[model samples]
Target: MHDESTKQPCCNPPWEPPQVIPAQVRRVNNLIFRKINQFHRENNVDNVTPMHDWIMSYLYWHKNDPVYQRDIEREFSITRSTVTNILQLMERKGYIERQSVPQDARLKRLILTEEGVRVHEKTMLSLHQTDEFVAGLLTEEENAELLRLLNKLRKGLE
Candidate 1:
């Protein structure tokens, strides 16, 4: 009763239903990351990564507040170790500094150095340009729907 036309070759298995969404999402994520990285590199802002840019922005925005490694870990949903590594690297690159708070000498707050602020501003401009370009590709309604669907997918994984 098997249809010979439906049979897949031995070297390749048929794509299952469950693989579609995740694969597509991953592809989109990778493509966006690469595009942003390339854009940054072209602008001669290649020292910091996309993640570092994000963290720097966070620190910049919350400059008045005391931001710590745990705060970053929570905000980004990344592991403590990963945050530590990224922060350490940023520190080594002179993008940030960990200063002990007055309340507790052991507790260090994350602060962006002057160079970090400059880089963050430069990168933010580049990112804004990229965002505008991507947004131009879709209508307002399509953009809203895309955001809703992306949030739903991310929430489902959470």
Candidate 2:
């Protein structure tokens, strides 16, 4: 017979539930980021990180509109300096080019170069595969609900 009073606890005393939403979200994000980077490395796509891919994808989608560094900064919720450095690197890598608009010479518009388009298209397939892999982990209804909850959380922050 077991001695209830002398039984060892499976976990620490006064165990707390693991309900940290932000930390869980961040961990998942890091996992996805690592997976995408792995895809890039395996595909021989050099000098392109997930951040660079995202910006290039954004520029590609919004090709109809004139996008600037500020637009990227606002969209990604990053600082001007951070965006500037990333843009500079992208330019040097031939993935993007900054052009001065006639209306405001000081305002340089972001445009994806031919190389950017090529790489963006290639990397997008990997991204979509990664997304599908993640989504496949949940049921359709669960995925929908997760999206709704995530949107709610994002709106709360905004």
The lDDT values for all models are: 0.89, 0.89
Give the 10-residue window scoring lowest on summed lDDT in candidate 2: 12-21
Over 4 Å off in model 1, which ranges?
1-19
Question: Over the stretch 1-158, how does candidate 1's per-residue lDDT look in tens digits?
Answer: 98999787888657875488878888877877777777788777876698999999999999999999999998899999999999999999999999999989888999999999999988887687678877888999999999999999778877
What alpha-carbon RMSD in Å does predicted model 1 have with respect to the real structure?
3.4
What tens-digit string does per-residue lDDT give for candidate 2 at 35-135? Answer: 88777777777458888989999999999999999999999989999999999999999999999999888999999999999999888977887898889
Question: Each model's number of backbone clashes?
Answer: 0, 0
Which ranges of candidate 2 are over 4 A from the true structure? 1-17
Cα error, residue 148 of model 2, in Å, equals 0.6
In candidate 1 the C-alpha lDDT for residue 7 amounts to: 81
Q: Candidate 2: deviation at residue 10, Å? A: 23
Candidate 1 yields a Cα-based lDDT of 0.89
Q: Tell me each candidate's TM-score.
A: 0.85, 0.86
